[model samples]
Target: MGERAQQIPFYCDGSYLCEPCAELCRTKVQRQKPVKTKAYKFNYQCQCKFMRGGCKLRYQGEEGVVLSEEERSKQKEDYKKYLNEKLLMMAAREVPLNRLNQQQFEFSLESNLENAMLYDDEITRAVALSCIPPEIVDLASNPVQQLKELVNWFKFEFFSWCDKPPCPSCKSDQAVERVGSDTPNAEDREYHASQVEKYLCKNCKTTVRFPRYNHPMKLFETRTGRCGEWANAFTCLCIALGHDARKVLDWTDHVWTEVYLAQWERWVHIDACEPLFDKPLTYEKGWGKELTYCIAFSSKEMVDVSKRYVVDPVLNRMRRDRVNEKWLADTLQQRREALWSMQGDSQAQFLRKRYQIEQGHLDAGSAHKFPSEPFQPRQSGAQ
Candidate 1:
């Protein structure tokens, strides 16, 4: 009414004004721009903020029932039992094969010694003198260094990843009738259990036998295999070269090799498939695997080597605990001992040493207390 053109509705915040003044105030409010001040530095001044605003230091989730010390002890024991059993089973399958291969390995070495550069001192020395660069040879001052060199050379030599060796007769790239003989032949006599894939050459009326030999010697001659054969054969070569190595198996369905580095006092992972040496994170970090168990089996012993791959043990071990810990442990222990004895070729001295070392490994729970450098997985499409 007084000095106003129109009547304004009553405001929420009771400031009395006419329609024009109210409209003007609304326009001014609407036109006002937001203050372009720096973002507020929040220290989570509220409990709700702390709980819901994603504070790193805050408990990640609702706290579960606190485990008793006794319960925790029991769990650890059970976990040990379960995990060891799996380890032993892996050992059972691999150790026998290793033994069978080992039995024939020495024979193979002897036959090839004259031609094998490393085994034959004459040829080896000659190569060292004339072939290998002096600088490179000089770098191999230790066994590990020599191993790296051998591994690099091996990568070049056995680069072929042939599943079925091409028919030698007609050089045909075709599959023939794969025949499995119940018994062994003259050439396949030693590798009796080895599945002989008899391919009928489409080109020629010839039967080509690809004896999928588990023997490293056979692998050496053929120079190609799947992950298992590669790991198995490579480990044997590491052994032959006198570098203590093991066949590393993953419960997540993978296989690789690990050579015991005496100088570092640790087992270094080496995958001939990825051709990655000392890249333990190649699986978890690179492959993005949610792995539970990674067991290492040599002729002498087995160890739960999960720490080599997984950074967060607490997360992974939760899954491992899903199985019955007690029964698993007992059965695993029983089987391991039985299988260790079953090998029949393990040296008494080595067995004794291995036993002592394995006991030490068991006692020292949670391997990688110090842990290795934070593993950054290589960014690649290939896992």
Candidate 2:
């Protein structure tokens, strides 16, 4: 019976200990170990999959593969050598001969203008005419005439004051008086200053002041303005006329205009604020040259004369102001030298490579896998 009972399985009958096999069976199940995964890394050279490309290259670590201090030092030295070689090559390159040709052309043109045997009118006409294309001769005799037509058109269209009939808005019948005409011999500076203070805008009938310290703000308030305002307005107008003009900034950052003269093949300075017809008079006290004023388009002679009166503030600054071109060049050279020295240092190269690795530059296949430290096992629960 006992042998049969052992062969047969026993059943539980509402008791703490059920069948013998059931009491012998283990309740706690062991957990399966987690599968390990491969880590990814980056490679700097020939970036490709190692297995597919038949590359067995391994990254020891960021510290091991990174450029060493010695290597960096050598690289820097090589960089300096490369820079010097490049600089020498640049020095060997010849400047184009055409540069001298341009300078010579400009010099000759300037000389011809200064010492020309022709009368001022003839010279101006010739230069102005030369600016016009041969195809356009039938339409206009010269550039000057074309410019006059353009100015007339501008005056008629944009500047209502240029229209032959006075504008109805400004009561154009009121005589347009040239301010400083009555005081021809008076001090120009004092006279111009006074006129600016008393001047009023014809359009808005607003009082305008020639800012003593800065460029005029309300330059376009009227059909006309004081000499300073006129100069700026004319400069802006010339730009609107499809002419290249820039405001000149001088020692005091004094404002003026430079106009491209097609005939002269260069920029010419002009001040419209000064009377167009006035000739500069020399002061016995050496207070500088006196400015003469003239009417706009008084004559071709007036335009030619005005050309001589213009000055370049930049040229004047270069001549009179202090500059340190050599010092600047030397400082730049020193900085280049320092950079080269650092690049050639092996230590720097090593540090740079390490930095790149820390910044994730290594390849995925060769990346290091760290082992986690074992944790303390818990004691068996109290019975």
Candidate 3:
């Protein structure tokens, strides 16, 4: 069984398992040398048939080859060696990945927004028509108007939000069930997918592939995914349309975009899924969602912009245990140096100063609490 499968304590299908039946399901596999793959599902009927739905807990089979003791030891040794090498590389600052929290920064930092510009004209026309009258047709002159139009088009007409994908074979949304997840294969990686969700169709027993494509241009073809896809593609489009944009990643398992409006000289929050614009506090005050780290990634720089979104710094700090704050700060500074090294002195200086100002705000925000008067629910479905 995979690491994640073994850790699950219960499954929710409105089914109950008696104590004895649950104990049997838990220990049966460990006590015997199993012939089947170690994966378990909570949907099976117990042999006892003691309960109404017969206990939705059963082992798939006892039918697979087992690993020997020697092989297990070899695997453990190899993993330890790999970890040692990874630690050395991280210590050298060769990679910006957080040691304790790998998800603190994106592994693939190269911008794919340039690919999105390939269809700039098509997107421009769509955005122009999306705006309200007196309709702003020439987006080149008015960047802010252009951004608003683009957001409108992308959110309402361009992409879709998928909760559970419809089963292709049975053509039923409810027929498909999530079995497990797997690493993206070579073909799926072409779309820049980090993971692929596996679903089983009850009617035809067909395994469906739901690759969460991260490359925005590739997403133009799929047009359907969760918040990750929506934010990715939208951020790409924002850059493609000549707006200075960044992909804002929330460690709390959400993402959105931040576009730098030169007119305002600051970044503005935008959520393509909710179709919301410039509402940084919406996640905290409106949805009552507690936030931790909110990092913004652009082609030039990676920034820590958590202060702008967090409701109460002291309270939210409790959830910010992924990495020591000082270590994270130092790592970010090192990464900024590396990323900005290629630019001219003037440009590099400008970015460095801007980053300093942003960090100052983060430092100041740490000392206070925010008002809770504007409490509201999430605009869309659950993130």
Candidate 4:
């Protein structure tokens, strides 16, 4: 039977075979694989390969009601609004501890550093250095001077500020103004944006959606936003430049960065938007912005660094009513302990010692002290 298998009339059109041959054919037919069918999505509707000729099998399921584009959009908007309300209600009741956990986890991975280095190519750095002063280059060994050069290079040469998105048609910033805000679209959400700001171009009457992308890689291309984008991009660059950097988020509508200068053995403020280095009290003392909470997020830890900025801790304490003071303190301590435990013994000891030193400075009300430098204007021309 093995040698004769090739001679068997398996594909005979209508030929009749004897009983044994017929049984073999039947067995072969029974063992044969079924033909495979494919399915795909087209115009938000499922199409089955078997019923390719005007298939209506999709109507048999919950997708029976084919919604109009307008109806679908309305449904999406309603759902987003409902979710936002729920989130606000939840935030009112409790501290958003998950924000710290999720954000710090992203930082802890140091994914931003690699992405930043990849995005900020050597070509770009070379171009930036060409414009930097020779004095700054000579003082490259000094961490303070190194940071100043980096900030100046980043702000003046690398990135631009966007108070309002420029008109795509006319390419004019003067005519583009914010009209409204909405939830981020699928593409925007893919890049990790919380909101999409809609701007109207007066020249062309065109509406543009500006998604505030948190990802540093995306910001490298856009290179124009408020403090959030500047801080996000610059913090990553600081890490790439071999400085211990962390993103600082001010709850009272501002953002910046903190870099731990080993020579100084303390974290100093560096706002790329301001292009300012070691200016911790600029917001409170210079800009007169009421500071409540400033949280610094790094790869190893999430710290409540509000004391570093707030000129009056007594008054700032009154503004920090989002969570019970004891609860917030306990939560921060637990997070620090959890993060520190993940490190090697030496690293954990270093972090604990640093934390103690920072706390001592905060206690002594000397955390805001910054070296005197000539008053420098905001290089970004940000209002």
Candidate 5:
């Protein structure tokens, strides 16, 4: 039964891997080379796809198959057709998306405005300013690292407010398991849908509900979730810190965050669950699992950053499915331009800095140093 199940590619679909199975998933490509595959989703489900059917988790499968020139031509043609169709589909949906976008923008920018409002007030404003790091301007130090530290601070101190919502009736430590049912809200149609965490209190028999809120600020108040809630809360906090941080969604059933560290001129990966910062290789190297795609989104832009997550883009590109790469690129660029048009000249400079980073990844000729932070050579190396 286990072997049969393994044949079907789960593709990081809320699966958990035990340690032995996780290690097994980390197949050795060559004795000298290290493993690069992630095998766990928290402590619950295993994402182990050890040489099964094209190991959908890592995009690792069927080693010897090679496409002919004719087949390559067909793929190129298909990709182009896909891009065209996708463009049309996007265009058709823009009106509805625009409405949704406006709805989002209304409640969204309020957070920014509220911060500014707090700044405008004399007393509350001063209190908020107290959290600003005094050493933030020290260019000698990596601001990216500082921002990461800031994220860790928020993760530990602010957003992850409690482990889980305490049982309302009795404040019991024992978790009430899912005996579920709840009314769906507007967020189900607007953003993402989540299973309502309904738990019946063992002690008092009172029902407790944890509605998956899509709003970042609301999440800040609620603050207890798996990766999804943490990512949302942390992204909001990053924005609160006056940085271009984003919620990075991995189609592999995981969500994390990325912050655009101006010091390094690249996005630094941060996962609040593991409470990790700038450790992109934690999954690839430590967990020994491969990733397919991690698309980062913001109010201003969206970019496919799978290249920034792995050691070899070519090897791991196999994990990407359901969409053509060209289509993906074109779609992301279109989204950026659309959002950019809305911002006008206000954010031109910020967008340009961000665009340059995106463009760097697009240039096929350049070597991709996967998931590696740019290194600074010591100034007095030979001195």
Candidate 6:
């Protein structure tokens, strides 16, 4: 004869389900009784197949009556408790942006030569810092405020250059070329070169390069340049001020700057290249996001001992030639790695695509396009 089946207790522990014989004597009991009048309510009462003397182990919650209000309330309370604990943990672990900025600022301050030409005097530092538009300064304090400052700075400082300036040679207002945009196009390059060659500076009667590409030209050489030159000079000035500033190469290879602000604890993007009359240049396609110029740095020993011998090779090279793909690719890769490791999602994606193009797996012509400029840095020009 078959052995008799043993009955199992419904509630065991404080919750439910016994341990020793619970697995073998599993069963389900419905709370509501079946109603034949209503089809949906029919067979409301059900039991687990195991309890029905069947080998199969099956249980259904919906087949039974709805949970009681007390049970529902208890479950909701449990969930709320879990969520509150999680929020508290997150709040406690959060790192303030100000802390990060302070750390970076301290780092920069400690890692420089005592008498580097960039910091020859305190006055130069003050001037350079002042030149930093409020937007760049506020990036560390408030990103939204920085963005507002950037828009206004670009509009008033750089964009206003689109207005025709009196020709340096003729002094005739009519000679001003109303270049709609400050972005150097192929035509602009030709015009700029032509103007430099033809127009003599009245103050010195010296022929000047129209679109200055180097510090000497924009600062001490001709003492004047177009918007593009001004943008580059401004970026260099920021870098000289001990700020981690760079010229960003965006769509059309337009120039801009990224400033490491101490208060905001982040690098804030700024465009000082917009011509006075033109709309701010926005990235449309290709050319990645921004390409930064690589500055050659010598060791302290070399900088000190060979300061005179270490001619301004990089500067001279940058003035006449466009940067090559190999150098750009390597520099971009370094920047990407640094950014990605820091959890910069958007910047990482942009760099990855640019890296693929630089490696020749993708054609930049099809994948990237930039504004026309004749004065790109050339590898051959490197001293």
Residue lDDT tens for model 1, 94-200: 11224444445334322322112222234323432343344445654577677677666655664355555577776755645545443447677563224566666
lDDT of 2 by residue, 1-383 (tens): 11111112222222111122222222222122222123321221222111121111221113335666786677557655654454454433433445454455334323322222121234333443443344434434464454444434333342222212233446553433322212222333322222322234456454323322112222343444333344444544444334544333222222234454556443344433321111121110112222221111110101112212223212221222122324323533443344335555785465345334422411221112222123222111110
lDDT of each: 0.51, 0.31, 0.62, 0.64, 0.54, 0.36
The residue pairs found clashing in candidate 3 are: 35-62, 35-63, 35-64, 36-63, 36-64
Model 4 residue 63 lDDT score: 34
Select the stronger candidate by TM-score from 2 and 6: 6
TM values, all candidates: 0.50, 0.24, 0.64, 0.62, 0.57, 0.31
lDDT of 4 at 229: 85
Between prediction 1 and prediction 5, the one with superior lDDT is 5
Candidate 1, superposed: residue stretches over 4 Å from native: 1-141, 167-189, 192-210, 318-323, 335-383
**Backbone clash numbers for all candidates listed:** 4, 36, 5, 0, 13, 16
Expressed as tens digits, the lDDT of each residue in 97-141 for candidate 3 is 366464433343233333223324465435523432334346768
Q: Which parts of model 2 are misplaced by more than 4 Å?
A: 1-142, 146-218, 250-255, 275-383
- The sequence of per-residue lDDT tens digits that candidate 5 reaches over residues 36-62 is 235433323344543334432343334
Error of 1 at 307 (Å): 3.5
Q: Indicate whether candidate 4 or candidate 5 has the larger TM-score.
A: 4
Q: Candidate 1 — what's its lDDT?
A: 0.51
Q: Ten-residue segment with the worst summed lDDT in candidate 6? A: 300-309
Question: lDDT at 217 for candidate 5?
Answer: 41
| Model 4 C-alpha lDDT per residue in residues 71-187, reported as the tens digit of each score | 767765765565445444433444444555545544532443323333245554444344445665666578787888888888888788887877778878788888899778888
State residue 87's C-alpha deviation in candidate 1, in Å.
Answer: 23
**Model 4 stretches with alpha carbons more than 4 Å out:** 1-140, 369-383
**Cα shift from native, residue 312, model 1 (Å):** 3.3
